[model samples]
Target: MSVYSMKTGLSSILKAYSPTEREKAKNIAINKVRFEMPKLKGILDAVEAVNEHNNFQPLNEFVAYLREAELSDNDFLRLMSDAHKLINDLSPKFTNLVEALISLPWTKRQPPALQAYAEFYIDIMVAHNKYVQFGIPKLISLWIPADGDAALWPNGSPIEALKTELEAVHRLLDRILTAIPMSFEIVLEAIESKFPYFKKATHVIAGYIHSVLWLIEYKPIFTEFVVQLVLQKLVLLDVNAPRSEIEETDYDDEELEENENAEIFEMDDCPKVGNIFAFLISLTTTDDDVQPMKHPIAHTIDICMEKMFNFLNTKNPNLLNASAEQKLQLNKFWKILLSAFDNVILPSHNTHHVQFLLFYYCSFKNTIAEAFLTSLWDKIKNPNISAVIRQAAVGYIASFLARAKFVHLPVLKYYLKELCNWAHQYIQSCDQYRQNGSLKANIVFFSLCQAVFYVIAFRSRDLTVDRKSLLFLQSLQLSAIVTCNFNPLRVCLPPVATAFAGVTRAYQLAYCHAILERNARRKLATVYANDVATPEETLDTFFPFDPYLLKLSEKRITLHYLQYQASEAEEASVVAGHRSPRRQRKRGDSEMLDDVDDFIVADKRQRNIELARSQEREAQFTYGLSPGFHM
Candidate 1:
């Protein structure tokens, strides 16, 4: 048959076919193209000449071109959109034509055509993906870092070698990130009713979700593809996430913040993001049973937490309103959530960002979550960190303690004791940090100290630490000496000053009491010789109010500055403010949070400075902030 006959035949079939019939016709046409693609391979050089000279306008259109009796792939997508996807117009028609040739079976006469077409298609996709949406393009750059080789990737693609062909491959992955998942929406509909096997491949749906999240700016754009991605990555418990997720997920973006020290505990059977993070937490401890997951899993979890915030942001999922069990599960994972407090979401790094994350978080429980808190005193005293991170961490801690005044997490007692112990050691180690003044080290120290403070102050009394309740006050005084007062951003303290400053002064009294108790234990052990370490017995505050926190609160100071008057308060009738503990929220969590957060601007330097003054003056005053605070 003539090439014109084939083209006319396909177009006529498409124009007349019904939806069901079209799909069938598309299959037949696709197979025909497969057969026909090779027959035209003999005329490749002629087409290349036309392409190189840029003189084929009248000769061939994008969908189909006939040069000297040779046929090319049809770029007419409307005619064959159902059958072939490579029918691109905006970028280059040559790409689609080459791709068609590449997919041809490698008969003796057409061996090189298939390979060349494959390489060309890859090159086109990479270029198209770049600078278009910039989502997938940006992502591929992260995954395919340049090695010395410039021709191909280690995984068999053309990326590792930094070749121009590989450059196009990268662009293609980027464009695919935006384009393919969109195609998945139609695919999902097909899967649901049109095809039986579609539901079985939810993993692919989930994979798309993970990408669409970054690409999508608004909620209305959520497609079946994006939803599936979330379902697979965050909610899917069956199969481990694909190996690509490891390349896609690890980042330090969620590095625990400076003042949050909850030692982010998690159950062993938790989800991948949490379970692996929990294991990483265990590596910081002395537990023999806490073996790490394989290194690859750890990398994936880290990536998910850091880079994938664009995917699964910790702020809140779009879907909510859990059953009692899910709520309980949420409560169960408060420790895991606590680890997020110190998390510095690069986007959410500012006070605005913190408010955004907290707006989603605060709706689940009154006051900030417990695991998210800090020791009240330590956050108050720290001068090393900017007041921005300092205030957010403190407010979260206060809210946490208010909630803690009720029945606690049960395991919190042990968490607090460990925090106290870690704080005690870490403050001492701050002096030894190689780059003590480096921002990373300071943030790490801030996070470490804050985590310790939460450990000591908010710990449950159930666990015994040396037969004495771990001294929360003593822990803060020590952690703060190095943290709040020792501004490495300014100058390092002298050795004697560092020693005398942190815990040495106030802790001497606590230490003296502890020493007396230890001596009594030693005397008894010497006499009896039965080996059992003393269990630390701690006491909890029965009263809802804490005078120590009341004195040190910046919230009170902010209120004093605002005179408790909102610049533009939400209307009492239109939007019942969250300030009314009794009022039911009228808006969505994010909206109500938006309204609440709308008033609290972080850049109000005058207000924060006044709050800082209040904290410095009355260390014993009650702040009435949120759930938890530094000791």
Candidate 2:
């Protein structure tokens, strides 16, 4: 009825679990049965019969038998589904099941282990059903994690074998993830507290997070929960120094005296508040997407920028360089650093020294608009750099780009130019690379970022918004796209886009929507002011010129494209060579200072006869007047 919490303990005895968990487990099973009632009866039958066999067969043979037993489509589905129920619950039966699962000297005893696993999974399926109908309150809390120096069990007890079982559970939690909730949470909690080596725990967590980001990225609600549960302990970020037996965080917390990883969780490790904020920041969310607001990932970037900057500043060079010296070995604190960095880095930007690094790396700077690309370039390009340092570079880059687009902000112009050139080279190299046998097909290989850039530059921020600089930018982007797709160009693109989905078409959609919606909102807010007020203000602010006597309507431009789709294709190109006419404004041009006398346009007719004749040389572009007439 009420949520089950680790914080609330009923002063238990030998059970290692609670009665409430058992009742909750029952509800989960009952609900699972109701949802898929037809398959539920057979599911129960299989769970009871799984132990009937003493002989073991290869998994393939077992699969064949399962098929022969008439359990193909829904039956297979329900069986898989049933497995979840058994593993999910923290009930008495489930607790006994966990005990059995961990107690096995080795689970390699063929059929028995298989049978036990099957029974365990069946419970998981039952639990899954309950969770769908209910929630975690009814879900099992099967794990009672023990750290490296764990309290010993009684003389006749059965937990000495828990070490192997815990290892299995660790692997299973990573492998199955949501399929085995209790195991996953319990393993994480134990690792959070006391694992012999942090590597084992970090590896599982990293894999799970990567898989979660890629596979279940769409399921923001669930992602949030998972990120929170796993990252919860990170909130106890010690801003000061690590003092205790556990490694210190990057910060010193006078409050808790606990060290913290500010990048992941930004709390004082006060259970209630620790991971909540950072977890909220990294929330598996797609909500602000509906409207133009900052995203969880943007907050992720901001938090990342702040924390990483702190760690970089405060950490001793030797301590930091140790990671580079060791390179992903014997380092638990830095593993989280590495994982988050990789997850957030772009493939294209391997280093900071590249001429156009800002084109890609600018977003990761202070702010998209304010990020000093030149300065950032200097920091990341050193050859002696450590791998984690590189990771920090990429994380800043990816998160920055993600944030700018999400917030409807513009990327800096210098980046646009370099990115264009980079794309051009990529496309041009295709033919040469193909002939040399070194070429690959995906140019935006890490083009998820490129795609978003294109959609923003080409589709949304088109000409008319600041002279449609994006059109030229788009031309460069399109050229790059075409060049990369071509096989004959002699260029190489660092291949990063293949594995990442959002980097391509999917991410582009996000870019398009964000820009279009932002533009639409701007239009709505300006409707009254633009239409009724003096139009001079709008024209001057945006165009910075004398308002046109006759303004061109967007419809006129829209209509031309609609009216002459294929017919004007060739005609469009010939005109492409010509620059569009621009209304001259006084402030921007440098030569304006030199043409003072020429800029004077006093009309000869308006001047007195004598003055008109005297000022005849300054009269320019006069209309409907005789040159000599000085009326």
Output the worst ten-in-a-row residue range by lDDT, candidate 2: 539-548
TM-score of each: 0.26, 0.23
Predicted candidate 2 versus true structure: per-residue lDDT over 1-631, tens digit per residue: 2234434754434455489998998767655443343333343343344444422222223333333344334444445445445453334322333333233232333344544454554454445443222222112122332233223321111254544443443344344445644544443344334312222222232222322332223333243333333333222221111122111221124412321122234332363464354346444443333221122222222222222233323322234456564443323323333333233322222221111112222222233324333333333444365534433442343333322322233444444455446446544565566633232224232232333232232222222144355344444453334324332111211111111111212222112222222333343455447565221111000000111111111111111111101111111222222333332322211221122122112232122233333223222211111100000
RMSD of each: 23.8, 25.4
Candidate 1: C-alpha RMSD after superposition: 23.8
Q: Model 1, 1-631: lDDT tens per residue?
A: 4567687775333345579998998767655554355234423333454556765532233223222123233332121232224324324445434434333322112324433433443444445542223222333233222334323332122333333433343344434545455433442342233211212332233223333443334322433343343323432221243322322342122322211223334332354575456446445543233232233333223222223333323334223775677555445434333444344321122121122223234334434433244333355447776655554454344333333333254434534444446545555666576345443445434443433333332232222233243353443344343433333211211111211222222223122112222333433455455665432211111111221111111121111110011112112212323233322221111111212222222333244344433323222221212212212
| Local lDDT at 478 for model 2 | 39
Global lDDT of model 1:
0.33
The per-model lDDT (C-alpha) reads: 0.33, 0.30
